[model samples]
Target: MATVRTLRISLVCLFCLMFIAGFAYRSLRMTLHSASSGFYLLHSAPHNNSSPASMELELQDLMKVIEWPEPPGPIDYNFSTSPFKTEFHMPFPRATYYVGEYVEFLITARDHHGRLKTYGGDYFQAKLHSPKLKAGVTGSVTDHRNGTYTASFLLLWPGQVEISIRLVHSSEAIAILKDKRETRPDKVYFYGFFDGTNETMECNVELAGPDICKYLDAQTGESWFCKKPKQIPCNAYKGHSAGQSQDILTQKEASFLNKSVKEKLISSKVGTFMVSPKNNTNDRGICSSGLPNPNPSGFYYQDFWQSRVCRNRAFPTPSNVTKCLSGKIIYMFGDSTTYQWWNFLLDLIPSLQRQELHMKYPAPQLAIDPENEFAVQWQAHQRPLTMKYSDKEELHYIANELDRIGGAKEGLVIVINCMAHFISLPIRFYIKRLRSIRESVLRLIKRSPLAKVSIKSGNTGYLYIHGSDWLSLQLDTVMRAMFSGLPVTILDAWQMTSCHYEPHHLHPGPVIVKNEIDLMLSFICPK
Candidate 1:
């Protein structure tokens, strides 16, 4: 009996040890696996099924993903369908219409295959420019996903309004644009700073290496990490060339709007009032101050931009502009668009001569018209700037720069735009930055009520896929909403640039620059 009891106790001890060993083995495996792997987050929404209820659910989900989703896709459909040409014909051709009547038509496209591209994703630009009436009105194009699309316009100006269409980009080209933005870092311009008085070093995007110039400004406490330039004191600096500009997909490309699109003109009178095409006398949203037309004021052409506001235009002539700007001090803070605006003003007003200021980087691109006591200066904002500017020590935060300006004098014009550079960053950064700007502006107004402040709206061109246009528009919306609550005037460049037929760009054509400047003058000396 004693021998049997001893044998059973020995077996029990062995089983207890095995259980503890199994538990510990599992714990060890879990720790080792976690250490060897990485974790990431992803966001997605699904869509597009036939049933009505399901369709609604799908759309709801998609809207949550992209407020405006692209035309329902083969989401990966080949852009090679290649739109060759587009034709616009009034469904039941109308001879004329009353003022403000909507004119609609069907635009058909045939691809390189000469097949009516049943799957729609082609980009087409349409315009209603009547040189005879001095009008250039932009119209909208809607794709039906059936190769047929809709073009609509409201006839605000009564004249021989002619229609024209051009193919901008095929859906395929846009796809390429979308891919490049995500897969490549080339489109973005980056900056970094070095420490301990690195005399031979400067921030350059051209370099490629593992070691980046990581810097933090001691005074402002701003931190930045930049890619190294080609040659560096830190042996690791190598620069990457700035991204290439998007090649404008024109007719010269494999596909374009078919050459058969004929110009259509509306020569009839609007509501029995026969108006002269030479001058668009109609007014709807025109204000005496020449603020942007609140209503759809078709297009008005007078060589210079004609706002819907009544003809009480400010600075109607070059000399008129000079007189209006006399004795004013202007400060500009922005990217290249604002830079171009400064250049335009310099050229238009000859008396404003470029001064030989010794300070190079942040000296403020200044021009002085001593004869008129007018001075305008443009300082490229700190980093993420489009050009390869030398990052100088004097570079100050925009808000700090604004705070430093002394009590503002009457006739002080401040033009500011912060779009192109900030596009690549997360939207939160932009929102926080603008909120800070709003506070600064409010303080400025508190100190000097007579000083003028203007915020330049973002232009349309950058696509959502490329962190521009659709994406930039969102930021623009935030900017407008923030400033709208403030007392400053907003120069509505978005509508002016978006509505016209020009290829959208960071630097718009000379015509756009002129219109923008003229509008500025209107606010400075509102008639």
Candidate 2:
């Protein structure tokens, strides 16, 4: 009995030692993981297929693992993807490619020293355009994770099509963009004016100081911080405006970001080719919600966007648009890019006239066609909207405005876009705002199942430290991921703008905007 008891005690001691060792190992591993992970809390949760809360927890866990491209070594200009050194050519090089066929090309990334890069994360925009025809289309780029990329463009028209590749950002520049974006929200600052006083303070999406005033939105849990003024109270904050942008890029970093290297065209020996005649046949069903987003979602042929996700229709005249939007209450909520849609519609339709709201610029604009029995309104989303001084009261949270609808009415059309103004901030901040909006969207859908809602993806623009295309791509990824599996339409303006022959603009030209509006209207009146 004595021997047995001694053996049992020894076994128990060994078990305890093993348990303690395992616990310590796990703790250390988690510490290292948290230190290296992206901007989100790390915690484990059980997967429960029955609950959305469980799904969201899982989604966040997935987001925690979504790593942006990082440089393998210290930032060096010699290691960055170089437009002058990188080369692209047709992998097959056929004599004549027919329309409706894919024109595939291979790109090999090289550094400034003309040395072959071993990894791939370079932002490249590939397009086949005919300047004479005013035709252009974005190519779908596939990275092989081994420094090689494939850009495939669908030949939509028969003509002399030239291939142009622009190195939008080097992998090193993207690393810099990721670092500055997650760490330095103050790069692009805002101005906060105190009421009845000549006092102003620098404001931002994230700031920390003993002299800072923090404003937290209870509904969305979104926080904004501003440097405290000398004499004015935090409550005295009245008007808001955009402030000067402080350069955060170092001289070494700026070398990779100069205009000469940034968005610069690479010289290619693969000259223009003639496309043979072929019918552009698409059997895509009528435009509706929940269409699968295809690669190279659509292309511009003769300056008009053709969506492959759905059979997009065109509202050619004022009567066509009026007929489609008749008996609808359309609410456009977003930054200036989305506002362009409202502006475009108002300009196109003579019956829709602007109402005298007597409000400030960038305020809630309403246009009504009483005879047509329809109304269109555009309101900018809440804070972080950087514009010339505007009234603080004018900015409203999109989720709040969405909730105020109290169950949408029939023929209700809602377009939501809040990504551009958010690129400067951390991805976590954007996620929080999206969660609030998602919840409101759920409730809105629950109340009115027939309500038409569409989310316009971010456009391609901004190539600096504060707002880089790479940074926007990160947020855009999160937005698409968060809103996935929901009943909403995504106007893929990202691909539209990226592949266009025209220059990249935050506010894309009329052709792109018209295409976006057409896609939205196609969903509204899918005949």
The numbered model that scores best in TM-score is: 2
Q: Model 1: per-residue lDDT, tens digit, 1-527?
A: 55744543443333234323433553353334321111100101111113556535644443354332233443322334443344556676555465567676677766555556666665665666666545666677788878777877766666566666655555554454444433444445443333333433334323355745543322222334455444443323222112333433344331322222211121212222232323334544333221443433335465456665444354545588778877677789887788888888777777778766554544356676756656677876655454553433324446545655557546667888887666655544565456556666777777887878888888866543244454565567667666654667777777677666466666789877878887777777775
lDDT of each: 0.55, 0.77
Candidate 1, position 213, lDDT: 55
Model 2: per-residue Cα lDDT over 307-362, one tens digit each = 88888888778899888987677889999888888889899988888877677568
Candidate 1 has what TM-score? 0.65
Error of 1 at 211 (Å): 5.3
Q: TM-scores of all models?
A: 0.65, 0.85
**CA displacement after TM-score superposition, residue 92 of candidate 2 (Å):** 2.2
Ten contiguous residues with the weakest lDDT in model 2: 34-43
